[model samples]
Target chain A: MPVIEVTNLHKRYGDVVAVDDVSFTVEAGEIFGILGPNGAGKTTTVECVAGLRSPDRGRVSVLGLDPRRDATQLRERVGVQLQESQLPDQLRVGEALELYASFYRDPADPGELIDKLGLGEKRKTPYKKLSGGQKQRLSIALALVGNPEIAILDELTTGLDPQARRDTWALIEQVRDSGVTIVLVTHFMEEAERLCDRLAVIDRGRVVALDSPAGLVSSVAPEQRIRFRPSAPVDDRLFTDLPEVTSVQRTGGQVVVTGTGDVLHAVTSVLARNQIIAADLRLEQSTLDDAFVELTGHRPAE
Target chain B: MHAFGQILKIETRLYLRDFAAPLLTVALPLALLAVFGLIPATREPDPQFGGRSFLEYFAPSLLVITLAMSAVNILPTVLATYRERGVLRRLATTPASPAALLAAQLVIALGTILVSAVLLIAVGRLAFGVPLPRHPLGFALALVLGTAALLALGLLVAAVARTTKAAQGMAVPVFMVAMFFGGVYVPRFLLPDFLVRIGDYTPPGVQALLDAWTADAPQPLHLAIMAVIAVLAGAAAAKLFRWE
Candidate 1:
């Protein structure tokens, strides 16, 4: 059975519908990503799953128990790192972890999580004294300290630098590898494409598309654009007449061919036949960003 | 209960690190006592005080200041800061409820209040030669009721204020009202007859506490008013408090 199943969940706040008709299931041991830009109801949907908010119009089941009715039990099994939530300014990193650890029946050692999240040197540092990246890492450590079955991390890398972001991504993968299911909420297309095994793209309180990153990319765009600089002059029709080629154009010194299905091979063959070497050859396909724009009809904020 | 203990332990540690609470709870009241106690005239019994020394008569104001500062100013700011900073929101996500965190904070505040109370009484006895409350039982009862009433007022401020600055701003009127009626602003003797009557209705029941401090018993009217205010304000605070 799926570890989490959300069906037709709807919630509104004083006539403002924060979440409406959001539905998805997270399988055990997989990293499920909820990808959307800010104000897309991504956090609200996960907050419902985490038992922080009650849904107005549908059923949500986690571990075969209702999220609201079994909220206490659910909290024990579902560790949540909320978006824009924080600890006391004077609380030390190790003390914060240990305090959270004591709340659960079974818990991961604070020392282990500190080391795992690279917060060892900062164990004695007060929360307010830590850098943004260090604070983010400590919050992640607090979430995992409870030895929960599922961990929901929202906007987990919003404040980290490039290297720290990469390091955090690696740490999340390691957490997933250790037999825990993960629900990651993020807006960055690259992070979603890299970390998520499957994702549900939320936009304006609805799911635009739900599939693997590659699947979403392929479903929206099946063609590839191959760009190369030819060693010798060539006619555009030489490539355009092929079955796989849709259009051929030359920009300055470079020839660009757009086609679907084995178009790269077909273009290379045409180049060889003309005794022209394709210099600086490159092929690019539609990424998640393109898929997002195609599905939502607007570019996602970077 | 176990989770509450752990959270309480951590909150205490954080309280020490910040130390604002301890300073206000222990040092501020003692400093007030020292400044006033140094006056030779304050130690002399005067006709204005009905044959009571200033140090003896002004003793209840020390308690009033300590309680009002904790319940109205210090505690509200701390709680409001927690809400503003999302500490309560994060706690709500864990197995331990946010109620546990609030309870822990209250417990820490109560600990400081208790320590301050003990020290105040000890210093009054040893240094200034003021006797303990004439009716110890009445004094203890007033202390409990006064604390509950003042803390209820503080919680209401904590519930309503959105930021620490707002909490401080909001607390001013409340703390001032408490101080005014508690006779910190104007001593009960100097106040008009009608105003002294109004003090009986206000929370912290400072007149009742003073009566219990030097007389046989606190007024029953003051205890009843404190109980009613505690329940009503506490209910309102519970209704209005926001986790985030």
Candidate 2:
């Protein structure tokens, strides 16, 4: 059974509909991602699941418990790292971790958790004194201190540097390895593609597509590109004539062929038959970034 | 109960770490008392104060100042800042509810005010030789009711203010007005009859009730007004406060 199931969720603030008929199920111990641009209802959907907000219409169940009615119970089982939530400026890192840990019946050791998050050196440092990345890590540490069955992290690495983002991704993988289901909300395609087991791409308050990262990329743009430096000058038309090939282009010493369905085999067969050897041949697959643009009609905003 | 205790513990620690707030809430009132007590005229029994010395008559108002300054100027700003910074929103996702944080804030504020009151009373009796409240039960009742009324008003301000800066802006004018009415600059006994009557109706009006209790003449009317303000303002604050 899925750990979290959100069906036909609808939420509105005043006249503005924040989420509309959104539905997805997160399997046990899997990293489920909600991918979207800013204001695309990713946060709203998770807020409902976290029991932070009640849906106007729809049903949400986490661990077989209704999120709204069983919020108190759900909170004990689910950890949450809100997008922009902050701690008091004067609060120390160890103090914050200890305080949050005290809320749970069975909590992870805050000292070990902080050390794992690379915040051991900053234990006594006040919140206001920490760097942005440190603060983000502390937020994640607090979320994990409860030893929750599931963790919901919104905009997990939005402001981190590339190195810190990679570190966080590794930490998330470690968290999942420990048997905790994760629901990650992010607009970064690379983050979703690398970390998420499956993704629900949302746009304008609706799920446009739900699939694994490779599945999404292939579903949107099935055609693959094959590039190589031809041993001898070759006619680009020779590649396009093949049934599997769609278009062919020649740039400098490289021959580029774009096609679907066994294009690599068909192109190589043609090159072999033509008495020409293809050197440094490489096939490039479409990325989630490409799929996101195709599905949403715009690039994910930063 | 466990979560509430944790929140209270952390909140108290953070509150104490904040030098400016404690300085204003605790030390400022004592400083003012000491400054006024040094004047020989303030130590003499005065006909204007019904034969009580100025130091003794002003002692209750000084205590009220500590409570009012904290509730009006400090409490609202801190709570509003928490909301603005999403601390309350963060707590809403935990088993420890945001209401725990609000309750913790109230407890901490009242706790600090109680400490300040004790210190002020000790200093008044020791350094200034002002008499303690003769009707201790009435004095305690008036102090509790007065704190509730003023803190309720502060919560109302916190509910309406969108940001910490806005809270501070809203709190300052209210603080000045409350201090003026509570006889911070001018003693209530020395105020014109019309001003005194108006002052009697304000949240700080409890100062008059405290004074009456200190003099062993407890006034039911003053206590009733304070209780009414406390209930109404408390209800309104609860209704209006938002987690985010």
Candidate 3:
């Protein structure tokens, strides 16, 4: 059964339509990714599911409970880490965790959660004094404190340094492994490709495409590119007859060969036959980012 | 409710953490009480004014001012900041009703104002030999009315302020007018006859009525007027208060 389902959802702010006729289902125990550029209504859709904002026209269900009708029940089961959330400046980390814990019937131990998030040393520090990464980890800790069945993490690693981003990614995988269904909203293609079981790419408040990262990439551009620098310059005529070789281009002492299946075998055989010893051999597969741009006809605007 | 208790704990925790702000609110009034109370009864005597010493003149006004500082000057900024920072909205996601949050705030405001008033009166009696209130019931009634009135006005400001900064910007002008006219920094009767005549129609006038009841010569009519102002201000505040 799906943990979350939204059908024909619509939300408008004055004349601006934030979410328009969007629909998606997040299956239980799957890492579902909602990928969109900034202002693409990703947050709005999630907010409606979290019961933070009321939709004008739509139906949303989480854990078989209506988000608006059973808001309290829904909130108890789902954890959310909002974009740029803030706690009181004077509130210490430990105190904030304890306070949030009191809102739920069964919550993870504040100390244990803080320790897991690597916040034990900064437990006494006020929210305002914590660094950006520290704050993000603290927020994740708070979201997980309820021991929720489903977790929504928005803009998961927007400001984190590379090391912190990797740590966060690990933490997310750990959370998912615990059998909690995760709905991740992010603009980072690498994050979506790395973590998402399936991604629904959105544009202009609408879902443009939805599929697994690999499936989407394969659907858009299945061919691969092979590139190498020859130890000695090879004649272009030597590789012209291979059936799998779709196109070949060379510039600045580097040769790029593009083709479909078995291109590697075909190119290597042709090179060997011509006695063209190559250096710096490399093969590039189509990335999710390429598929995104291919399908949308533009880069996902961050 | 449990949520009310939580918000109360949160608000009180903040107040306790900021010792300087709350301390200044309480101490400034108490210091004035002592200074005015120590003056000799015969010094700068005024035939028309009822009090023989400054302490007798300022003690009740000090209570009104204390109420104004907490409810009017301090609360709007804090509540507005909470609204702007998403604190209130975040809490709203919990089972905690907006009523619970408001109740917690009012409880803390009353508690602080009561403590400040008690300290000021204690200093008035022990340090300056100011006589105890001749009419205890009247003093209590006036205190309740004044606190309610000020708190209601503060809520109105919070409801109207779009941002925390706007709330801060508003506090300066409202506080100055309330202090200057409400008989805290300046005695009402000392004003020119034209000003004194109109001041009674405002919060200062209502406070003066309550203070009159504090004197050996009590004025029930003045207490009645203060009660009316408190009710009106409270109604206005309740109508305008908003969470977002």
- Number of the top TM-score candidate: 1
Q: Which portions of model 2 show Cα errors greater than 4 Å?
A: A251-254, A277-282, B186-191, B206-210
Per-prediction DockQ comes to 0.84, 0.85, 0.54
Model 3 - which docking category? medium
* Predicted structure 1: lDDT: 0.88
Candidate 3 chain B — worst ten consecutive residues by lDDT sum? Answer: B204-213
Per residue, candidate 3 scores C-alpha lDDT tens digits across A196-275 of 99988887788888899898888887888989998777877666677887888997999999987788888898888878
Of candidate 2 chain A, the 10-residue stretch with the lowest lDDT total is A247-256
User: Which candidate, 1 or 2, has the higher lDDT?
Assistant: 2
**True-vs-predicted CA distance for residue A167, candidate 2, Å:** 0.8
lDDT of 3 by residue, B87-173 (tens): 776666654565676777788888988898678767766777666766677667656665666677788788788988998787768
Q: fnat, candidate 1?
A: 0.88
Interface RMSD to the true structure, each candidate: 0.9, 0.7, 1.7
lDDT of 2: 0.89
lDDT score at residue A67, model 3, on the 0-100 scale: 81
Off by over 4 Å in 3: A221-223, A231-245, A260-262, A272-275, A295-297, B41-48, B97-99, B204-209, B216-242
Sort the predicted structures by TM-score, highest score first: 1, 2, 3
